[model samples]
Target: MFTTRPEIAGTFGCVSSTHWIASQVGMAVLERGGNAFDAAAAAGFTLQVAEPHLNGPLGDCPIIVHDAATGAQRVICGQGVAPAALTVEHVRGSLGLELIPGTGLLPAMVPGAFDAWATLLRDGGTWTLGEVLEFAIGYAARGIHYVPRICATVQTMRPLFEAEWPTSAALWLRDGGPQPNRLWANPALADTYRRVVREAEAAGSDRVAQIDAARRAWYGGFVAEAIGRFVAENEVMDASGERHRGVLTAQDMANWRAPVEAPVFLDYGNTRILKCGTWSQGPAMLQTLALLRGFDLGALDPMGERFVHLVVEAMKLAFADREAFYGDPDHVAVPLQTLLSDGYTDARRALIGEEASLEFRPGSPDGIAPRTDYAAAVERARAAHEAAGSGEPTVSRLGASGGDTCHVDVVDRWGNMVSATPSGGWLQSSPAIPELGFCLGTRGQMFWLDETLPNGLRPGRRPRTTLSPAMALRDGVPWMAFGTPGGEQQDQWQPIMLLRMLHHGFNTQQAIDAPAFHTEHWVSSFWPRGARPGKVVLEGRYDLGVAKALQARGHLVEMGGDWTEGRLCAIRREADGQILAGANPRGMQGYAVGR
Candidate 1:
């Protein structure tokens, strides 16, 4: 089988990401003697500037890291928490909204990406703040070629920006008018980074002190002040068809910081998959793996109808559990142990049959009833689809305000590895803060308004975010670091890549380039949250025979464009000190580099 591109190989270091600029920046850091952490931080910051429409500095990130020195793996919880004043009562009673709007100040959470990256650099990296930020600063100041998707997104939101978000219009539009397919510059954002660097440099000559100083400047100083004022004074129109002011304050930004915690691990065969805690949809992947463990996956054709149907059926069950049980562990006690137990997965696996099950069924873990309204969720999805037709592609949806996130995977010569998914704060999500050159993320939209649910909107609770990143280790050694940028499809696309690699011995690029499919049978995490019962969206590259067979099994089949399913990237560290990397060619943006 031919891949779109060659799988890069090297003995030094490797980097892969959604954008070529970010991948190049990571490679440059590696070439400069920095490790994987340093390269990942640099690439993560550069992604904010290179793919601003897909992600920004104010977004959230959930990163998985493996250190060779200690043979320890940890997850940095970069997903921001809801503001202190944001609660179900406040949103439903005071704001008079049924669901959190998908595109405005009301849905903004505390910005976590900047602080999280800084934390990683401070604790694990071997570079200065100024060194890592230099690439992003240069790009924002000198300007970069505007991608056509970005231009089209801006054009779609031009009317909304002109009427609602003038600050965004001023930053993205030229002379208060549309400018497409030209080199675009964000001087304000460049100045913002420069100011942070200047503050860090002034703090001291020590690298750690300088990093701490940069953190202060972001969380306690000018950055926080500007964001607080903007959210407090501005009222912007969101997905609710009305304008509303946000509840986030400067206090929220100051009070919150990203935390380092242990990853939830699942031992599958000889490989152990690591994901973030229940706060993300990561464990859903673990549950799927658990269910599939009962079957001989290698015996089935990798792209056959039986394989697709079995995987889709298992995914539906896991996602159903996601809607019912997953939430912030600090607020709700997730029956994680029971959910991942072999006994439970065996019972769940029994539900799989020859025909597709259109019903949403979440298991009773530990004999506790699940907390979700399947019929209501289905009705909401149907109403939303009727009102807004099927949403656009990843890059064009919401006028590019908020659709997908961005991913970076890095592995250095010394065996240090990091897989980080940086997302949120899209150019179309909210009005850009005039002085900051970025907008707030609308991640809070993932929270349900009903207080009775486990994932109900609450003060200080992390939203059950869809931003899931994955890392796996073989025999207690870091083997692979991989992830994608789809909101809900993050975990769905991962299993295919893993199966191909484990069963058929596919290389990184071959695994990523293989045809993929996902079921939208559960409620979506975005605005107008809806579900498509028995729906299976497959890439057109898949064999037509497989599609027809799936349809015969009662799947509401839909064909996506060839190579339009995922934006996955991966890097692996071999035992012989060699590094391998791969990136998706679907969007014509992702690239992988090594040498």
Candidate 2:
């Protein structure tokens, strides 16, 4: 029932949502004689329109590119930076609120996607933005979809969108922004799209004009400008970038720019990993793999007792470093060298005994920094998770953030490859710049509310992001390029999927469709201050015997219900030059097609 054109040679194969916008974008690039980077960029831009609630053209994207020819790898940091109007004290000042409420002006960054598109184009793109974006513009104007998931999710948040921004509320809510299943359209947004295209054509490579046009529509455009003007004509944004902190003027929108830089790399055995810097847990991926190598996983069989225990131990160690050290490299001193070093991996691996789980609790380590605050940090995380109550958590029970994002993979006929995890959150908090058809991401909540923490809120600094896209190679060729969109689950899922696919000889679909588990069971790895400990959680799908087995062996085994949250889309290039791509069944809206 779930099949597509099988492993064809010289065809552009892509996987994304059921919506034609993403699919059409990929197909368009193929038709235009462009490669996978071009196809992936087009799909990302189109998803912004088709899956606006989840992602946007103005959202942030982290990408991994594999050049099959030179066998070189590159990662692009498409994440945006915080506004100049933010500070550490402001976050610490707001004590009682839950670390900035997960949404609003505070977390919004200068959108980074356009710059990523431009960079991909600059590096090597045969198609123009106008060609790639046509399908998205048409869908925006004509309004062609309403799947069960989107419709249901939208119904729940209709009032929130309307109350925050009337134009979006109108476009989203239909008759005056209050109904659940109402069909809505924004001719205002259609006009904005038209204006952006005309402006892009006229400006000619002064691409800032196109960006300016989108920014104006989202902020000072016909839809949102009146709201901004009435709120505060001269109320400039203050040091706390939180929505309430800034007047969020059109000027603020005009000044933002996305940075494009080379990704940080680590060599693990024959595989080279390209990851975004400390802003996300890209480096930790390599660290986990390094530690896991110390054990003979192949000897234990894929899902057997010994293999599972070793992986769990490696994950615990990786999360230990993740919680204590990883943060925005530009802001904090992340111990990248030590964490990925063979010596560190060897020491951490030595702690794991072959027969039983370690008696030592998670985060039971000496302080890597000056103050000896390790014990205190652990206690806080333990208290918080325990307070939240454990056992069988889902999106609704977790007080779900509107963090739904999209992941897509493209493998071109030319042996080039691309993996991009593009993301944006709820649109209400930071009002959209009307004409832009996109809103700034309120990702600021990723930081600590405490001023003393390493990831304190700051201006011009990029928040420690969760969107990590990655590429894996074997024998200097593109073996797999994959990633997912499950906030805290991103890092945990990455290694598990690799083990299933690489070590176990599973097909792309088999590895992605299989049930999996993660150890970082909480709000974010950055939480739970000083020496608090937790248990290892397994999926309910795993046999009860395995849980009992781990528990008997000195491990805490919590059971997640039978449902899976991580959706991995991947493509494997066979030795015969055919491309095999697969998407997870969990994503009802997902699909993969090639021609």
* Best-matching candidate per TM-score: 1
Best by lDDT: 1
lDDT of 2 by residue, 462-543 (tens): 6777788887777666777777777666777777877776666767766666677765432353222223233666766777
lDDT tens digits by residue: candidate 1, 1-595:
8999999999998999999989999999999999999999999999998888889999999999998888899999999999999988899998788889888899999988998899889888999999999999998999876678887777777877777788888888766433555667899999999999999999989999999998898988899999999999998777777778998999899998899999998998999999999999999999998998888889999989999998999999999999999999988999999999989999999999999999999999999898777777789877765655654332233332455789999998888999999999988888899999999999999999976677888889999999989999988778999999999999999988998898889999999999899988998888878788998999989988899999999999999989888789999888788888999999789999999
TM-score of each: 0.97, 0.82
Q: Estimate every model's Cα lDDT from 0 to 1.
A: 0.89, 0.61
How many clashing pairs per prediction, in order?
2, 34
